[model samples]
Target chain A: MAREPGGEKIVNPNPMMSNGNNCQRLFRLLLGLLLAVLAAGLGYVLSSLPSPAPGLSKPVAEHLEASGVSNPVTAVLLNYRAYDTLLELGVLLLAPLGVWSLGVAARHREPLVDPVLDMLARLLVPMLILVAGYLLWAGAHAPGGAFQAGSVLAAAGVLLLLSGWWPGPAFSGLPLRVSLTAGPGVFLVAGVALMFAGGRMLEYPPPFAGALILLIEAAATWSIGITLAALFAGGRPVAGPHR
Target chain B: MSLLQPVFDIVLGLALLWLAWRAVASPDLFRGIVLFIAFGLVMALVWVRLDAPDIALAEAAIGGGLTGALLLATLARLESGGGAGTGRGKDRESEPNDE
Candidate 1:
């Protein structure tokens, strides 16, 4: 850095650094151009393809009655492609477990004792819980489901934690573990049960599909709620001193 | 009224693009996160316009709300850890206290 005659500070660029910067700029420009061309080519090819006469939605709707759910989306999720739903639940459970594997954080029990937050939690948590339950129940007919309900439930838990009413380790225990795995466990059991009952794996008998889906959803909601809450907690909870 | 719908769509689309660009380009991490949360919110509106209320709800709740909260908390933790110990910046002392 040096002051020029005009009293302006100037820093000389190193030759090697300038060369590296130029290389990066060239690479970025080439990458952008290649991606743009690829995108345009793909778009052209896709647009040229003829549209299907009968879309998949029609068939999905036709078979929806047999899936035991009124909502076509729910029918598709809980019945038509239950394997995917099972895997998604497994992934949700994996998140908390993965966090736990990182080892516990130093336990500093600092309860945020703000009056406003406490009051807000008191007013909102119970109402949010009700909304979550409603969303779960409405999934059979409406645009809500285990995932949405579970997210709301997790939000309530987070609210409580923020207000300092709920301890960090409140969710840590054998019972919590069981609840965390309940969704995928129940889903697996249902699959195995169907296999034993003369149906293919995950192929719920038509008469019983509705009940099975509801049961699986209930379990999944619980597990998802716990999993999301644990993820926000950011570390494994050890057994509390009280425990 | 039909013209209004198209106008709204154009405006929303432009807003979404602008918010996304700013979110990705912001130099400050905190500002970037706040912009990202706003982008999620606008994206939820896009989902609503596309007639996917379920996705809109999920995006707003999870993407905008919970994810924003988690990111903010993580930022606070990081700042508190690095700021308090290293005394890197003059603003370090006041940062954790704000939380």
Candidate 2:
């Protein structure tokens, strides 16, 4: 360590430790080994898992079949696991609020722009939105559902963010509050009404079980998709005419 | 679960880990952030393969999307005063946080 013209010894921050070069290399090697072990453990656990059968979650299986949703996952997500769907919507809605809150130190709002990206967004957003609707409609018989469909819409929001097309927010305190609650709210109403009539939750009298599940799922899917999209868009209040 | 799911899990999980490594190893903060977002999406795929679709949902939303936004926003915040943490002055970014 050489003294300056002012006669002070330069206290080196890291002398032998140039830049944590070996520290980083060691970290990478450790991380790789850790991941490898994780993968092996996961494979073993998954292999040991019981395969799908009639007895494995029989209630889900039977209720799913009774719902007339040709796809069992769709039935599980909408009918048996409808509460999860509802809570997921609440989570989705809460997410943007969290993001926005983290940005309390952020400047209010900046003008978003990118011409080429905007043009591409124009081409894609409509089609993507249409597909989200279709997934909700066809979930009963297909491999898709409100969650997958909503994710697609969220991707569109990313495009809009890149292109500067989104106006941001779509009535958070009211519209979001309503839509987020609507799915479970409808399911609860249906359950109570069904119990009063048939003495069971989600158990319709006869042929109605199929119809009822479908109905509840459809509403749930719509609410989920819309709420998710709005959340993705940052919950900025632009659903209605903002001009 | 589909037979292909295991293959997807193994491949995607490795890919995710790779991206995360690159994100930390990158010489540019912007590139690091982008790579991290990609890493998050791949992790979400891993969750899907693990038969935990609910975790996938939360991860995709928060891990990939919202966290990406936050990272970019923080980078933007450092536009005025830069430091090693911000990869300011220089165009390069350093390694990952203390995981």
Candidate 3:
């Protein structure tokens, strides 16, 4: 029997409950042992693998010109494996959708006014936005891309939210929804349009591939940014009386 | 310099494993979350060491920063909704209104 903080004697009605702690400990030990064995096996397998394993880098480099981006990662994502990227965007869009479905609106609280935080948000948000733009633009030839840029943008949004800046009602409604859907929407539209034009879905004409990739990336960055930020908000933004 | 790289890598790998273990086994929820974030940041460093800067950037931004924020916010909400010192082991059925 355990005593509660309020001096109430808590009785364990179930006899089996007495051994629960020991059972749990034994279970954990077994699980940990199993995991250790698995890890060792995996490590052994990895160590036995061929060094510098032959990959598709050669073929990717060969087709890089036609893929419309100098960066092989970007080429693969936006061209060779565009369908995967499209689906990925769809998955990203689903996050906020699932969160919003929980029907919990973010509780409106009084803004905590801290001068330093306010100044930091003001200074950092714009800089972060600029960095996101640069990242989107540089994706064609660098490590940065829509996902990274969008995450940075989300960081900025989170900073603002933390510093007590809420989106205006006007911006949070239709505009928010549109931005959230823009990535997958654009990708889907492009794929369907390309199919209509007699090419395979998401097949970019070699001449127009660069332009199309940039457009898709820009939309994806926006959508991902908004989606992640909305996800952090944790629920639907209920306005006016409902809020 | 070459020897230093290997030493650094070994240290980082051990730190990552230790942090991950501590994060999982920590008794306090807040401490566990903070350790998890530290684990994430360390994981990001490992990604960079593995020459995957893209993954590193994404991991740092999303995994470390945003996840930490989300977890802390959730903890705060849980504490507020359930009242202090009673955030855990409470009956879910009793709390009808989240606010």
Candidate 4:
């Protein structure tokens, strides 16, 4: 063991240990340089690309009216490439599923009963829910959409959890499961039903496209909110009598 | 106005890079996580600067807020579980020796 002049013990007293630290530092520096070079190369390549790059914006705009949403982003996500969105919902569902499959019970901590946090949670959660609803609805015409809205809703859920509010046993069992699955389930069912209704999977009739997209977004928002919060919970709820 | 926007963008880009490096290199795990969250937020601003508000919102909410919370919670759990060679315990163990 080596001691500093001020009588401080050096954890890595061995000369070889110091060499190893130098090697680690050198490796990190080299890696950073490599990444920087790669990034610069990528930027150079991007800069050389033709301005006003050819894209699908024209075609998307041409068919936007039929896609049922005034917002082009919404149209792209829900109508133009709905299958991708459906799979994304599945991927979101997989997260909580994987976490829950670990079968660990959520750690129950003693709830800190702070008046300010309690009041904030009470005030903010409802407002978040409202904002989520507005986002979902306005997504048809603006920048708002299911993902943004669901994330807001999820934020609210996270806040509630942070404030030490846990779902009741009754709500956590079947209802919770349903909410978690609702987005993907609705999407899958809609696709299958459309397939059976004399159309290809997810090929919405222009007349009903708006309604269908809205329905899916609504379900997706709820499911995403609940699913994300369940992820924050870090485990499955213990099986109550209802289960 | 145009010059100001570009200058702001440049500063933001530099800040993002600095924050990212600090977050990765910071010795303290908690400080690293907080820095990472800050990095996420700055990245969100970058997204907005690129005119991608949707991505910006998602980044702010999921990337910064939820993920930060999750990381903090995981760190707390790791500290409480007395995981060897991880988190605050290592710092605490080395603190007295340093003095």
Ranking by DockQ: 3, 4, 1, 2
| Reproduced native contacts, each prediction | 0.19, 0.00, 0.28, 0.26
Question: In candidate 2, what are the lDDT values of residues B51-71, reduced to their tens digit?
Answer: 766557557765787668757
Q: Each prediction's Cα lDDT score?
A: 0.79, 0.63, 0.84, 0.85
What digit string (tens of lDDT, one per residue) describes model 4 on residues B34-61? 9999999999999999998878988998
List where candidate 1 sits over 4 angstroms from the true fold: A1-16, A49-54, A105-109, A168-170, B82-99
- DockQ comparisons of all candidates to the true complex: 0.25, 0.13, 0.30, 0.28
The sequence of per-residue lDDT tens digits that candidate 2 reaches over residues A3-99 is 2222222243576664565665687789989999999999999898887733646676666656567777776765666567656656755665564
Worst 10 residues of 4 chain A by lDDT: A1-10
Q: Considering lDDT, which of the candidate structures 3 and 4 is the better prediction for this target? A: 4
Tens-place lDDT digits, model 3, residues A1-243 = 122222222344568875875676687789989999999999999999999988999999999999998999899999999999999999998889887776545643556799998998999999999999999999999998999999999999888888987787788789999999999999999899999999999999999999999999999999999888887777777665434
lDDT of 4 by residue, A110-221 (tens): 6789999999999999999999999999999988899989989999998998898888788878999999999999999999999999999999999999999999999999
Off by over 4 Å in 2: A1-63, A96-109, A112-115, A165-173, A204-206, A229-243, B1-16, B24-29, B37-99
Per-residue C-alpha lDDT of model 1 across residues A49-111, encoded as one tens digit per residue? 887745679899898889988988788889999999999998888888776776553322467
TM-score: which is higher, 2 or 4?
Answer: 4
Considering summed lDDT, which 10 consecutive residues are worst modelled in model 1 chain A?
A1-10
The segments of candidate 4 whose C-alpha lies over 4 angstroms from its true place after superposition are A1-15, A241-243, B82-99
